[model samples]
Target chain A: MNSQLAAYATSNLWLIIIGMGIITFLIRLSMIVLLGNVKISDTVMRGLRYVPPAVLSAIIFPEMLQPAPHGVLDISLGNARLVAGLVAIATALISKNMFITIGIGIVTMWIWPFIIG
Target chain B: MEHSQSSPRREFWAGVKSEIPIAIGVFPFGLIFGSLGVLGGTPPLIVFAMSSIVFAGSAQFIGVAMINAVAPIFSIWTTTFFVNVRHVLYSATMGPKSQHLSLGWRVLLSYLLTDEAFVVTAWHYDNDNPEDLTHKHWFWLGAGLTLWVQWQISTAVGVVFGTQLPESWGLDFTLALTFIGMVFVTLKGKPMWGATLSAGAVAVAANGLPNKLGLMLAALTGIVVGMLLEGQGAQDE
Candidate 1:
């Protein structure tokens, strides 16, 4: 990775940023702009309802279980992120407050290492 | 109820006000992304440009990390595409509501469409009567602009000063926590729960897949499961 980073070129980075910006914008614009007037099927509409929870959970699970990106999954208490994520989940469920959940989650993540050590 | 009475200016400000708290939650992420980008060897100029250009938080983080790791450009683009495709869903949901707007309005609002902005704006759309949606797009514009400004400012701060902050502060975890809050709040009814859990499990199991294919697969699985369950529930009633 270090060697690759060393070999990385500024030109390549520019290419990436431009390419990513275009693709992301198009994705965001796909339905709202391109298909603005098209009639969506009921089935697709039903499926869209779940998109938020499903996509979000898909994101949340990996961040919590793996903690380290592309690393092995760790469900143990040793994984501070996992434990803290659980705390955040519980706080969200009970308090139904975004501020409280994030506050407690970050605090837990910060303090977990000392607690276990 | 008073949809027609409210001017576009009023709705726009209302949108901005509603998003302030959520924007506060999102502020840390912009900072983390900026600092991480620079620390990962990306130039400060490019890192800052990314906030304005790419705009999506998760995709930008992943893209910067991949660039730092010297991942192939194709893989980086592919990963970013999938990670952000969820915006397509958001756009689809918001499309009908904004269909009446001019092309320029649609274009601008689509650019501003984001998870945080979408959630708040969608909630507003859903709660109000469908007949009363004339100035709601202004609200979306206000909300989106607020987040957009906050993101740029935070990213600037992080790029300029974030490296001085300790990495051990684990500030990146705030993004995860924010998502957790979002997921739980949107989670109502059996189908939503089933979809969320299923998506989460699949994503974990499929984590080893190349180029983050697992995320897309897991999301699709969850959506299908949720739709099936909803269909079944309807039949049972």
Candidate 2:
């Protein structure tokens, strides 16, 4: 079992590393270059401010609540992440301090999994 | 010509000063990115260099993952191109405020632009006296420099021993957390809600799209939906 896991790790290491770097660069480069040249209206600009939070949260909440693969859809685990995330959110909104918000989030993530699992 | 002709470095520092406030939320993201890049097997030195040069967090993270996955250069380029398309909208919005500045300054700012800068700067504009982009500019410099330094330093630290870090840490989700933070800061009145809610709904529904372009498409869908709502209001009043 150990050897199998080790072998899987060794072979895929380099492939995973380079792929990550290239994709990351491409995403930001396009934004930097493109946003540099366009002409935006006030109404549109107001709208764009909201995009990151909405999309990211949409992606995150579902993933955090249930996770993936095994798909543990039970209310307890799901509720834990949901409640914890809200707590983190409130902390973030009130404090606007990264350490405090993330610290709370980490605690929630660690504890919730154990309590519910 | 006046400012650039005098001192390019001065302009650069000036830009950095004005751009600071928006950088606050972005800094931790860079720290997390650095932590993740090293943990994920990216070379330590290159991690810092990417932040200094590329200077874009989303791209750096995507690059870190794609390079390792060996998903082909073409896929990487396309995904990046589409993902960053929102900047086109962002650049357009900032144009009126930036037009008075030299082309060189415009180009420099464009390269430095990211989600945080766009959000903070976009909120504070007035059409009649547009050149007075004082606070907007400060917010960007504040935000950008803070994020830039954090990206390099944190990644370097991670590179030193990031590889040994465990998967359980899930540093990947820092991007998500950063997004949540920015969302809270940017969430305003109703028009904002329309774009966000519509975009999110589209993303969730279309999550099956290849290359995760569903999210990007959802944002595009959101822009249109937002425009329509505003248009409807114009007609109603």
Candidate 3:
């Protein structure tokens, strides 16, 4: 139940909420607000282009390689997520369609457990 | 389609139409956030408000998870901020296209900006003729608002039906799949492949790091690798 967490969330809810709102707002407004005056360097812009792939891979890799409860590393055929992720990657490469990639990925995950069992 | 370039109304609708597919893709993510928030014991009102006010999907998910873990408020703020630092890049990309806009329009557009909106608007700006950009902010507006409205609605729906989804459905994987699709579509060259693989390797290597700092390290490593590759090419030219 985490009474302390409940208390903290209840008491400071507005502050945390408003804090996140302002922080996110400012980040979104940063370069836009400074528009025309400050130019992002070409090198920096080049790096910026990698942000999506990097950030996305950072997010996705851990999900597949390290499944929760903190310590087991799963890169084997037994890891359903890893297998489904591979399937999704292939689907994405072949079709270049997000809908199909996600659809097949989900179906693979659903069916993987049954096959493994 | 051609008429949209002239009238703001038409331009706005075009943006909405362009965003429909993105919105559909985002809908489940929004629902997942709402359900995650509720399952974490956050108040429904707070979940609703945060979804509308904060409006960044991944950040909101992290914020709620942090709160549930009883993490310090400051750390929560910091994590969310870090998670959203990517928007600084998005804002920079959108700046040239939107700079001519009025203060009010800029402010509203900045507020509406999201990953989906950025993709749609970036495509429009890159593809459209330079002469047609005058009213293109309307297209940005349309796309941003479409995602905004859809996010709020989907979040509310998730909160209402929290935890009802069967565990076997593996809905969370869809988010990752969506990101994979994004990664695959955006991969145009060797530098991108290098960036993605290096990031994944670093993220896996740093899996045990606390507070998801592994993600930050991975992103930095990827950017650096990509930039180095780009620098090598630029020098040869």
Q: What is the TM-score of chain A alone in each candidate?
A: 0.82, 0.58, 0.80
lDDT of 3 by residue, B141-224 (tens): 999999999999999999998688665566766677777877785476778888999999999998778766787789889999
Which regions of candidate 3 are displaced past 4 Å? A1-11, A69-72, B1-11, B69-71, B127-132, B210-212, B231-237
Per-candidate RMSD, Å: 2.9, 6.6, 3.3
* Model 1, global lDDT: 0.86
Score residue A3 of candidate 3 by CA lDDT: 50
- Per-residue lDDT of candidate 3, residues A35-111 (tens digit): 76776676765676677788778878877777543547887888888899989888988988878887888889889
TM-score of 2: 0.69
Off by over 4 Å in 2: A1-76, A79-82, A90-103, B1-32, B35-42, B124-131, B134-138, B228-237
Candidate maximizing lDDT:
1
**Candidate 3 chain B least-lDDT 10 residues:** B123-132
Model 1, range B1-237, lDDT digits (tens) per residue?
Answer: 565578889889989988886788778889989999999888899999999988899899998898888898999899888778878778888887787899898888888988888877877787666568778898999999999999999999999997787877878778778889888855688888899999999999998887668988998999999998898899999
How large is the interface RMSD of candidate 3? 2.3
lDDT of each: 0.86, 0.56, 0.81
Error of 1 at B146 (Å): 1.7
Scored against the true structure, residue B166 in model 3 reaches a CA lDDT of 63
Sort by lDDT, best first: 1, 3, 2
